[model samples]
Target: MAKGQVFVSMALALLVFMHVGGIRGEMRGGGEEGDRILALPGQPKVSFQQFSGYVTVNKVVGRALFYWLTEAVHDPLSKPLVVWLNGGPGCSSVAYGASEEIGPFRINKTASGLYLNKFPWNTEANLLFLETPAGVGFSYTNRSSDLFDTGDRRTAKDSLQFLIQWMDRFPRYKTREVYLTGESYAGHYVPQLAKEIVTYNAISKHPIYLKGFMVGNAVTDNYYDNLGTVTYWWSHAMISDRTYRQLINICDFSRLKESNECESLYSYAMDQEFGNIDQYNIYAPPCNNSDGRTNGCTRHTIRLPHRPHPIFRQMSGYDPCTEKYAEIFYNRPDVQKAMHANTTKIPYKWTACNEVLNRNWNDTDVSILPIYRDLIAAGLRIWVFSGDVDSVVPVTATRYSLAQLKLSTKIPWYPWYVKKQVGGWTEVYEGLTFATVRGAGHEVPLFKPRATLQLFRSFLSGQPLPTKS
Candidate 1:
């Protein structure tokens, strides 16, 4: 009788220990499990959970960066975590990357609803979208001056801090492998942040398990980007021969401020490019905001409640007004509350691209190749992909920039197939991988979602893109 009681007591103790250990692991994210979101206003029902809120990078000044986390549909606990960013120096990642690209939902055409994204990144990995630095989206600083005073180094530092503190909120993710990715201006943001993480991991006891980074249609080097733009335009027959010649002969993109002749040619090129079509994807049609358009001259003029930029339009959808539709959906008061985005209720409304930051961007590295080289030397996976049709940051610019690195080709360029069709071409280099998405524009995933997913899956899995016939 005495021996039986002792055995039963020991079993109960072991069970209690296991239960406590499991709870400790579950204590992750932003809310209860750290920032666990109950649900979005119009979000589809799913077993996977989500959370959104701010990570106070600067506790004293209350400089907090907002973030949205969407768990994987299948195995949230076991999958890797991808921290995604969208570039604009001051763009809203939630607005563009999440809503438009790889995120779980897209704003419905009605601009008053949400629709499921069939190929959301959350299907595979846990997705976290951040509004970095400050004064972009709902992120803000108590010292409002920080809005105008953000730069590359400062932004990177704040981002590193946000990740660390964010992990504190979602402790379970502390040990998971992390992939940092972004597009457009994030060419700068991702590399710089990855450097910070690698540097910190060297000294810190609890380090970020950063595996790699990828940027798409990114602004890597200004000179190469500009030169490549003109080259691409001419090569693709998008610009007149005279304009192309003038740009090449007279313009010096390497110069800090372009010469009057260069500026004139550049302006002419842009004017021709932007007039009838979107500058992002050259082949895409212009957003005709007239009666024949989708909304048909509704009272909402794309910015009645929201202040739309005259020069910088909100036309991301297939019709160019999809971006405007996204703006409406995001700006809804109920959406804000559900996502826990604007806890501080900042004054300025959310815009996809923040014009203030773009104009007043205090610092920009001429070339991020040095950083890329360093990361590659550290044995980090480095991939740079481009949308072949993106005039803004065309594949030509990426090719030009990578050529400067002169990495020996490990795998000669070849077409990577998806669904038994050639999706795009890729080259695996000694320290870098270069890829191009065919028939895609500036935002590759938005233009070619399924191909983008195949590309991304191959990247994360450390596999070459399939060449099978």
Candidate 2:
């Protein structure tokens, strides 16, 4: 009734309006409040911040990419952002990258609890794991056909779009120094995405500050890769010398089609010569369970090489059945809800790699060496690492591919040390660096967590892998 009372009420109303207006503004810019994860089921207490959610790359088709961000253990705001992708071409980065390798947590054997990865990469950088393309992991598209037609070009474009929109959501990272890293098919995805980012920065008003990229046991040049692989089989005594010769002579990787002899020899090498060992990590015990299905949603009596297909399971080393655990863990309703995944209640269960997308993948660059050259010339820091014991994409294959680069060596080959022991070897070229984890398998981190952590620390700091004990 009084003039003073009326004035006070209007002031309070204005303050409330301002507060709501600010919150709305944050949401429009892709505020991360909604995405911030409180905790995960059975997860151990952690000091760092975590966030996960979907970033829609294609609104028209309703295609969304899923990402999980694990902030640095300390001073997260000061750490650079590193995006980790796992290459299935159809695999879920969440399953491989986040749940096992480099991520903050590791799923237990029973899929009932989580344990901290002693060497989590987030210690040095804000690690972001992304399940790329529409069909992988929790990432999905409303348009059913999108799954069938996914390929390199579209995946890169969508990823760039995701980053752009993701930056809008987590604006602090918009201009932060960023790096791309992955393994297996991600060998293709990482470089392709880097090229996309470099190209995009040229024209976009908001540019992603891509500093460098690193891939482990990556699928690089096909010819060299095939050549190196056969050589590795022979050198490691996995295949007979006779089979090795046949592979070298008969398998023409450059050809678009395979000859019958090549097919037979390859099959013979795998079926008979290679034995029942884990191809991803030759020395490690293979998951002898014959019932592991390709979909990996359920267990049955089946002989499995364990892990995933050669193209996607880059990081299987010690645990032969780690992927099965990932399957059991991720498929939990509580886990899905905590991560804000599978909100649509998709008809199919979450699998590590989508066979349909991998099979139907339309286009693949025969060789990523050209893109490597471009990125190298553009002065981006590039590091290619391989695990020596990986039969699928062995160290020898990576060595052969880098030799083709023909860059003069900066730091000659030398053993890099970790904990007073030889961890691996490294050589720096003018534009790129190549390293090998001496006794590791397909995925270096999974086999040699400490060694890989040193490698990553050196990479982020632009330092050489330690030459001293």
Candidate 3:
């Protein structure tokens, strides 16, 4: 053949090879194969493949859960799968965990774009984020009744179903080591889901392998959480002695909203503690232009502008309005299409937390300590890390809950180092482990990404956090 013809043939062969081996559009899991995102709108170009779509957990309830999965930066097949859930009992993992915390891309300032995260959790392992239960973010149900009535058991079981079906789609992961972790109310969700997986595995011949689980700044025990929260407020000089006294004397976390005194006192305390401050990050700066808005992004204590898409948003200096940016990004029609989300076109806009589910959230247990004990006994790796500055589910509460366990220390408490600095303190026990993120708040990875990543690396490796940098 002529040289020109040979060159053309070679080029065609290269194109075919790249199409087959290329990283951009390969579908890994089989189910909902059409769900593969060819490319996200405005997403920075990268080689890794990402999948986002809904997994129907219950057809009767018309319940479907939304998920976003990013394979490990390298050798995803070799890396263990780490499933992350964000607590709120009503929050979206995709919103808080994926967009704002440790996901690969941070929502750009324009809300119509994305930016690469310098410290994405996907670098260490496959990151799977699910917007669980129903009526939370992109996850929803056709039955309005289910939307308003979400509880721990339903949430856990649904999460399990989602996972089992997800494994079916990605059959290769059926036996892959799975580690469950979550924060906030997920303190309850992760343990409960792990428990369900264990129960399911007891009957199934091929079980979803469970190596360990983790919860960060979680609501493990209600009484302790409340107690720690009040103490945190007062200790941080956020509340007065009188308000603290009221919290001490009258507040019961189990029915925190029922008692007029408890509700009123806590409201007053929050007013004092949260005035112009980020409730999620007490010292973080308030939004510059969005501040003082009456009814936008206020639940997360964020101030958002009236613009359809705020152009003044920033991706730098830890912007307080990141959640607003995320809301805008996730709600965009093109972005949704690229993500394969909002399949049914839910009536309402996507928000960080589901108020309907939050209002009706049925917390069965005051504490998850008993579940932690049981998992520990089962020889599952259990690690609990707390961002010390989180007043919502204060480290004090976490310590108090673990103290109730009375597990002997396998490794005496010591500061874990990261980059030659004290990242946090860690304690290894006979059954479980606990650590503190030195200056982080409710969202550990958001405030201390590097340190949290290091903590994560240690947990995944089943090794103790470093004592020296």
Candidate 4:
């Protein structure tokens, strides 16, 4: 062949190689032949082995299972089992639950250490955090074409299957008291999963010991959620009464649609100039750059514009608390090894904001109230707690959603006092209790560790929430 011909042939071969490599990368986990259980990095020095179990649903896609940090903890046979999930429709519980909130430990502020939380929920229970559905966290799919358009029903089913396989892996915990807890989006996840567990227990003769569920600042109803936020903003003076009234007129709380009206209303609120209003008093404004430029708004920025908010000052105190813990955690090599977290990955500072993931969550739909009602009827304890400063899922929104239950408020609405003041309020009917967390926002655990722990303790004990006057 001539030199020109040879050069053409070589170029063609290179193109083929690149194309083949790309295809292979995409196909790695789509089929039965390619399914796998992923190994977590930097295993804790403790005794637990990170195990993977596959739940074969269809021929193409299988569920990636994550088991305990067994090496670090005790024997499963002797402990109660709790399955924890973080809501995002796409979030990993291991990433958020284990790293940020009520896990056994909190990641150091610098992501360089592990500090034992004074109020770790797992201390009282054997906790297992799951990255659910097919695409969350370490969970994977062999099919590259698998739909990421997950809804509540699909997630509930996948989680139910995961539980079945998980129990089989650690059969000792099958009869142990099993509680499901999650924050934010897990509001939808927990109820649906519990409903499935209850339904399966009735039909299969093998009952999973599902005792109760807890959701913090969960997204229960979109309409009520928006309305509550507006009210919160007005109450906190985040927006003037004039702006709040405009928001009410322009935005329809009943329908959750991304319309020009909603956008314009939000834009007006964001752009509205207030004279000498304390930004610290309300949550900070949303960043305008949209390029994932800023770290999360300062705690003040994150707070909803509102007056008389419980946790207004608490946001500013997080950094000091996080720093105090980081110092202790980073000093321990064992903890560092267990997290396998890249200290450099810590953002502008080590706070819990992951802009990429947070942005993606905007598309998620959380409509699982029916599931909650179903679980309540099946005799499961359901508790919803809201951080007063979280405008996204404000306390008012939570109360609005509960009001729709029309359950004839058995106990009527009452104040829930902490420290001799009305820290928040609670209302109970049937087995469901909706309460507010005083001095807390979206991430309740970080803001009010003591109050958050108290809520969890009450949940685990199966006791009715205390009424405050």
Candidate 5:
């Protein structure tokens, strides 16, 4: 054949090869087949596909993040992608976001099997739960110092890298609208990562389809969070009048470092005055199992700046301890092998939260409100919802921080209903929506699944929360 004829043949062959490999259009990565989860041990059979594996964010330092994608129940192709992160500065999204809050499977307390969550967010959209920053959950790093050096800045950058690479692996989702969601410290993670996505989209030939972000009881401004937390404690009668006055007069939250006196007072309130209560959900009973393991309640907290306070884990109901079950289920050899996790066989057992990483956290933004402002001005759909009963990152604190934005209220605060009953109250601002889950704690989905699902639906549709019954 002539040289021109041979060139045309080669070009056609290349196109065929790309199409067969699922790389047509804007798709650019591989490994989808290998990552497909056939069946997790003891998991209930479900129709939708599930994929979980690691995505290397850095080669030199050998850092990789783990992710579990639970596709939509009905028509995944028509659904948007929603990414969920949990904040402990070190908590595993696989544990909290996946097993307890929004993901489809809920681990049985016996750790022997899995059950379906009737209100799983995957029912509405494709859910992506990530264990990020290289030290959380099954995600790991070859370099030992990476654990000691992690903070908000590095976490956000690394997460952005993970997304860029992950989208390549599941290239079909490249064009799907993506929304970032998380709670607590993810308030920092979600917005900071959103800023990074917005920045990356401005310069990249193939940008992520980032739509917006929503956070629950997120840590926004340290000053406002601290002020609101103290106020919540006082208003709820968790502390004495004298203690409240002392906290207000002494704690200087504007500063990066809280004084020793401030720390002592705060610690005293939590330890002495707070009693044996679930700080995550004050109205709930504390898990008092002897091992602190049987009840499935794993203690987790987000220490802000220099204030270290112990808080409760995110589980369901009055005293449900679901995290212990997650730890047992995830650490099982068969389960890990099935999910493609712990491939490196790091020298440790999987835990819900990494204390070392959380303790050694190097830096924090002190406030994430600046990034929120930037994203809001960029016309992204930004929503901040709070589970009112949480004292750790209370609704009061969220209100205080958002008040600083001074966005004109487009819709006055009104009751939002689900199933003809008041689910919560919502108020729309010029570029943001603030809603409250009436009786929920820090983790809204865990505490109030149906209401949160309704909230989630509203967020995805870019519609206001239902004002009518």
Candidate 6:
């Protein structure tokens, strides 16, 4: 299927009522055997288990019931818990979190190789990646008539219910420090979920010790985010002054929606001067493959050779695809099963960038800014990271969205040296911090694995940003 049509189908599927009750029928019971969920057979060597059963959220009738992923390594008594959600309102946490970001494994482009990621985010603390608000990923409902028309309110309520059920399943970790993390559109998911957690704590008196949150190159505001992209292009010297002015003048920031038109506007700005800027072209169609016949291969092939060539260029300056992590993730059957993904169904060539866009999620609300403020005020550490080269949710957009907070700069911005003058820069203020990864686009981990690993380590430990000096 064409990528555009596939996205349209996914959007339509969300509109239809597909009963997902049967998928959770076997989720009864408790303990290791019950919790040690195994991935379906035929996946790579990674193995993970689901700890908590389903939670029914009666607060909202049409939108209820959600599930959470438990770390493969268990410590039921006294381990911190982290919950992760991918954006899209329909994208699977397993698809992005497990496969692309912090999960233990990453799939090879051809879906033939599985490699282990040395810095799987879960290594520091227990992690839980969830598909919330139902109809997303594997979390389903028996009510084929259930409403999948989800928003921040429904998602927050459903996620709260899921956490309540999760705690009940493993009571020992009830007091464990809980953190929420996500990327892309999850700029909406994290704050809303945190607010729900705080509200539930106030009323129930039994709260999931919500610690902090981390989001990467997220989408929070429409006007600033769109406008920032134009400035970012100019700052990076990818666009000319005339083209930037054209974008600022012609683009409708108010009716801002993701579509082919958005792609065209950005394309015009980038093509004004072609100096090999992949960031601008990240969302635009390739100049060579306008027919879409060669299938978005033009976009993916720009970084390295396709097909007979190595899928990943080794950062160690050796053969591409030589990293131990990539090899293990692609090859691990357990990780695949835990992800609950069907690699066979997806195209053999899968890059984080090549995934189908969610056309159905054109309208998103940004009212959750207050919730983020509340979390920061409550003394939770917040970290927002961005891949400077990612045009989808670029670093420029992040800065503009954060400017809405009106936060007092407690700590001034400074370079976060990764290796000599490499890595990137970081800024700390009050309880929140923002950082960017050098040479990395949207998928920071995929592009700069070692640097990303270091960033996570510093984030989890609450340690001061590392310096290469």
Q: Pick the candidate with the highest TM-score.
A: 5
Worst 10 residues of 4 by lDDT: 303-312
Question: Backbone clashes in each candidate structure, one number apiece?
Answer: 7, 7, 0, 19, 2, 29
Name the TM-score of candidate 5: 0.89
Mark the regions of model 6 whose C-alpha exceeds 4 Å error after superposition. Answer: 1-24, 27-32, 38-78, 108-114, 142-148, 257-267, 270-357, 419-421
TM-score, each model?
0.86, 0.88, 0.86, 0.72, 0.89, 0.75
Ten contiguous residues minimizing lDDT sum, candidate 6: 301-310
How much is the lDDT of residue 207 in candidate 4?
Answer: 81
Give the runs in model 5 whose Cα sits over 4 Å from its true position. 1-30, 289-319, 343-347
Please give the TM-score that candidate 6 achieves against the real structure: 0.75
lDDT of 1 by residue, 188-293 (tens): 8999999999999999999999999989988788788778878888898878888888888898777556777777666666655434555566676544455644
Better model by lDDT: candidate 1 vs candidate 2? 2
- For candidate 5, write residues 31-112 as lDDT tens digits: 7877899999888999999998777788787677888999999999999999999887888899889988899989887998
CA lDDT of each prediction against the hidden true structure: 0.75, 0.78, 0.74, 0.57, 0.81, 0.59
Candidate 6, residues 285-312: lDDT per residue as tens digits?
2232344332222322221111111223
Better of 3 and 5 by TM-score: 5
For residues 66-126, what per-residue lDDT tens digits would candidate 3 score against the true structure? 7888989988889889999987667788888998788999887778788899889889888
RMSD of 4: 9.6
Candidate 2 vs candidate 5, lDDT winner: 5
- CA displacement after TM-score superposition, residue 406 of candidate 6 (Å): 3.2
Off by over 4 Å in 1: 1-34, 272-275, 291-319, 343-348
- Two-way lDDT contest, 2 vs 6, winner: 2
Q: Give lDDT tens digits, candidate 4, residues 137-190.
A: 434444433332445666787778877766665666678888888877677778
Candidate 5 clashes: the total is 2
Better of 3 and 6 by lDDT: 3
